[model samples]
Structure formats: structure tokens, C-alpha cells
Target: MERQLIAALAALALVAGCASPQPAPVQLVDQQQYTKAMRDNSSTFTWPESRKPDLAVLAEKSGPGRDRAPSGSERIVLEITNSCACYLGWEDARKRGDQAAASQALKVMDEVLPKFSPEDPDGQRYARETAAKAKAGDGSQAADYVANNCDSVLWK
Candidate 1:
């Protein structure tokens, strides 16, 4: 009975370690500003309320109230620690001459990339930087780079 209990606990630990990581929860910095950023403003698409959490990794600038751009508008900012493994998986497939898998990965990236709305200047800048990183390599560390070395999506 003691051996069986120990084995069960070990199995539980293994399962726990295998569980997928959850995205960090996003917080609203300013309700009105967040609302303003969600509207159609200087972009092809209007920011949606549902996709706010998708905004993460970087902001347009530092200092107080950096999340807001255009004075009164705000974008969602989540701690960009987590990464999507799709980019690495895509790399593996291309390396193995697996065109079908590579194509599938491209599709996922397409779906994922547009989540970075270009409406906010910070979002546009982040999107551009992320695209550049995607072309460079596995692209997993792109957000880490932005968070560490860059500001939110501000214009030139």
C-alpha cells in the first residue's frame, strides 16, 4: 500500500508538470482610455473588446501612464513572459522538409499576428518589430526582446 501511494503521487507530479501554461491575466489601466483605444482610429480594423488580453509583451513607452497613446487612449499590457510554441514547432517542421506542417504553422502565425492591432501606434510598432523577428529565426524570444530593450508601439 505504501508503494502504491508513492507511485500515485509521482504520477500526479508528472501530470502537473505536463500541463499547459496559462496566459497572464491582463488588467485594464484606464477604462475610458481602454475604451477609446478599442475604436476605429487610424487603422484598417477597429480594436475589439474581446481581443484586449491578446495585447501583451510591450507598451509604447516607459514613465507614468505609458500604456496610453494619443493622450486619452490606452491599450492592454500583459507581462510578456509566456510564449506561443507555434513558432518553434514551425521551425522544426521546415527543418525536416515537412511542407504540410510548415504550411499549417504559417496559418497559425497569420491568425496570431493580426491580433496585434495596428490602430494604436504602439501596436503597429510592435507588429512591425515582431514581423522582423519572425523573419530572423524561431521568433520565440521576440517579445522578450521588445519587453527588455524597447518601448511600446510609438511612432517615429
Candidate 2:
């Protein structure tokens, strides 16, 4: 009877282990939500007194900064390019006739693009594609592309 009881407990433990809960499903970024988040955090934007961009924080908030950042070339490509969706701000500013704001935002993107490197051909190609869109100040399209292709880290 004791042996049978031990066997039953072992089987129960195995069943319980297998029944562990799964992680939550990823909630992808939505443009309207991203827009609201950006606007809400606008006043808190600390772009630095020296006008230098916080590449690390940008990676964390917008791209793959820490654990998500893998060594493969494709990793940084997705990260910086994904953050390039910031170009959307520039696009919106231009539409409102705010040339000064647009110029500054564009300049910031320009400075950041060269910093995104990919050793592989595929990564390089992707980088170039992102760079072209950023140069054109296509923020809306960029955000859409990031949502579809990259990890869901945009508005987190």
C-alpha cells in the first residue's frame, strides 16, 4: 500500500508540473496608442543639454537594449531601425509647418543611422532600407513596418 501511495504521488507531481501556466500573449504596438504615449511623455523628453541622443535608453525604450539584444547583426538592425519610427514625429511636425522641429528631429535620426551596423549582407540590406525611409522622414510607414516585422517593444 505504501509503495502504491508513493507511485500515485509521483504521478500527481508530474501532472501538476506539466499543467504550469503559460506566458501572456504579446500585445503589438498600435499607431494611435503610440501617438498618445509619445504626446503624454513629450514634456518629460530629456534629449540632453548637449543635444546628444541616449542611444542606450533609445534602445531600451524603443529597440532591443538589454536581454533582447542578441549578438547577431540582425539584432541591432531591428533595434535602431525600429526606433527610427521616431521619424514619424518629424513627419507630423512638417505637416504642421514646424520646420525647425522637423529639422532637429531629422538631424537626430541622421546621427543615429550610421551608428547601426550589421556585419551580414541581409542585415546590411535591411539597414539601408530603414535608412532610406528615415531620410525621407516616413515615420508612419516606418512604425507600421516595425509593428509587422519586429518584436512588440514599441509602446512598452
Candidate 3:
């Protein structure tokens, strides 16, 4: 009876160990890795060399400045791009009729949209328009606008 009890405990311990949850896999992709992957993947966007300088400038100007935060237009452009990406992914999922994936993507966009500057008029306007459209179930149109106009609005 003693030996049987020990074996049962050992088996229970093994089962518990096997049932332990594991940490999620980490995804580490640096800029170089992203650039290389984008270059190799024809479907992915490869940012132009000419726009690198502008991107660098924007990166530099993004954080808090001496007087105030970056301009509303700048913040709007950034938020739009971010939301647009989410919407685009959602659009793809919607195209496949994957309601769960689409809903998840929209949830992500909803979380991000409110981060835009409410004080900035242009930013507020952009946010309102986007939110209205999203609420009206025009996510695909918003995604298309973002994918098509990112260069004009963002890079310029």
C-alpha cells in the first residue's frame, strides 16, 4: 500500500508538471530584420530611401519638445497610420469572413484611436471622422484610404 501511494503521488506530480502553462513565444524583429523581410516579401511595403530622411526627422520630433508636444497634424498622421494598419488587417480577415479576427482587429483599433490628441483640432477631427466611419461599419473604406494615402499624408 505504501509503494502504491508513492507511485500515485509521483504520477500526479508528473501530470501536474506536464499541465503547467508555458510562456508565449517571443517575437523579436529589429528594423533591419523588418526591412530585409519587407524587401524580400513582394507583398509587403518597402519604404522608399528618399522618405528615410523624413522618417528620421519625424522620429526625432515625436517626443516632448521644449515648448510643447508635436503638432496635432503630426499626431493625427501617426494615429491614422496606426489605425489604418489595424483596419487593413481587419479588412483582410473580414474578406475571409473570419468574424472573430475582424472583431479582434477592430477592438485593437478602438483601443488605439482614443490615444490621439483630443486638444488638437485636426487630430480631433480626424479621430471623429474615423470613429464615425468605423461605427458606421465602413472599416474597409477607412483601411483602403489608409493603405492608398499613407504616402501622401504621412511622408509629405
Q: Compute each candidate's TM-score over C-alphas.
A: 0.29, 0.36, 0.40
Off by over 4 Å in 2: 1-78, 81-85, 133-144, 149-151, 154-156
**Which candidate number maximizes TM-score?**
3
In model 3, what lDDT does residue 144 have? 58
When summed lDDT is taken over every stretch of 10 residues in candidate 3, the lowest stretch is 63-72
| Residue pairs in candidate 2 whose N, alpha carbon or C atoms collide under 3 angstroms | none
Alpha carbon lDDT at 148, candidate 1: 54
Residue pairs with colliding backbones in model 3 are: none
Query: Higher-TM-score candidate among 1 and 3?
Result: 3
What's the true lDDT of residue 72 in model 3?
A: 23
Instruction: Output the TM-score of candidate 3.
Output: 0.40
Summarize candidate 1's per-residue lDDT along 123-155 as a digit string, tens digits: 446645555556555455554554453233322
Question: What is candidate 3's lDDT per residue for 1-156, written digit by digit as tens?
Answer: 122322343344455556768633323333344333323432232222222223333333332222222122233334544555565666667788988876776666565555555545775566557656776778655665666645432342
Model 1 residue runs over 4 Å out of place are 1-83, 116-125, 128-156
Q: What are the lDDT figures for the candidates, one per model?
A: 0.39, 0.44, 0.46
By lDDT, the best candidate is 3
